[model samples]
Target: MGHRGFKSSQTQRGLAMVELVITLPLLLLLLFTFGEFGRMLFQYNSLMQASRDAGRFVAGQAWNATLGKVDLSATLQSQTKSVAVYGIPANPNGYPAVVPGLTTGNVSVAAVGTDHVQVSITYTFVPVIGSALPAFYGQSVPLGLALTSTVVMRAL
Candidate 1:
């Protein structure tokens, strides 16, 4: 008589080890990519916050006729290590030697009236991980990530 009991062959089997081997690399790659993106986003946010702080400080100041040119850039440069004022011909690349992990670009400050001052901070963001993608040639990778921020405020 034929076997009347359930047969292992008839039951659906779980994923094979080979299947896991094939997908594990892809999963790990996706995880690493996501982590790198998160880090980049955090750095971008920090940069924006720094810019806002500097702009606000400048804007809240009382207008002084004795002050010829408000050196907001110098004030900001002293406040943080990652902030600097650009426009030095020696550093034409806009990379501020004083600031670490930040390259300062053009900064424009204009008096929008008698009681308002506009401050804009422009900077170049260099990705930590994306910049190294070129070393892994023949592998698919993302590179060349950059961002900028601007802030405006009113004088007190």
Candidate 2:
């Protein structure tokens, strides 16, 4: 017969709690780390897509020489910024709620050589878990990472 005074169940009463106490932080750390990394990747893809869209627009556009030297590059730049940020004509607040601090200034449309148009996007990513975790890669992981994407296409 089992011990009459002390039950086997009683001895294991806090076993799960002890295990949780030891592993909870580790599990949470991994969870948040993965989440933050995923977010960074998602934002990166979004930036690349946006830049590609802008590139497509600029490449297929016909240059306007209506105003002598004024040209339409400036106007094209505005449209490119709008398209890249909002995926539409205009959305004063930049992208949706996914990427924070993205603005028109972060996008650049430049003419490379005489036939190529380049669209570049720059963003600073601040990680949520980075601040709480230890430093890695010889720097504080929490320090914002600068992500940049560029797309270039020949002018039509």
Candidate 3:
């Protein structure tokens, strides 16, 4: 009876170790996935806010009266900064500073028509620990992700 009891205890201990080994990787994977998903959500929200602010500024402006002297870009840039905007890239002409995780483009204005503007932002997200997965595949596949958002508005 004593020998049987010892054998049963050893078997239980081995099973516990096996269970832990199987569960630990799954637990860590879930945690990392959740973290990446949260970051993506936050970035998407920030881009949306920035686009709305840019559109509002364009809609609130008055047409310039000076001939050959209209500089709406400056106005947009100022309003963008005043609103504490983020996640929109700067213009190539270096008018407004680019947001760290985003890029902006395709801005235009009309003289005798409604002023039109577009704001865009892009983000690249990477998993916290998933980057190492490619090694197991013998360097066969690459993993990368990107997201984009765009908003447009016309002056009233």
**Best-performing candidate as measured by TM-score:** 2
Task: Write the residue-wise lDDT of candidate 1 on 45-142 in tens digits.
Answer: 76567666656656655355566434344544333223324223234465644323554444455566566655555545455554445545586655
Positional deviation of residue 119's Cα in model 1 after best superposition, in angstroms: 3.5
By TM-score, the candidates rank as 2, 3, 1
**lDDT tens readout by residue for model 3, 51-84:** 6766566555633445322235665655444432
Candidate 2 TM-score, C-alpha based: 0.74
Please give the RMSD to the true structure for each candidate, in Å: 7.3, 5.0, 6.4
| Model 2 per-residue lDDT tens digits across residues 1-156 | 866886688588999999999999999989988998899999999888888987887777724445322123677789887778778656666447325678879988887766677888999888864434466567544567899999988776
Q: What TM-scores do the predictions have?
A: 0.57, 0.74, 0.60
Which is better, 1 or 2, measured by TM-score? 2
Off by over 4 Å in 1: 1-15, 65-100, 103-115, 128-142
Pick by TM-score: 1 or 3, better one? 3
lDDT of 2 at 52: 90
lDDT of 1: 0.55
Query: Any idea what lDDT model 2 has?
Result: 0.77
Task: Give the lDDT of residue 152 in candidate 3.
Answer: 62
Instruction: Name the runs in model 2 displaced over 4 angstroms.
Output: 1-13, 62-72, 92-98, 129-141
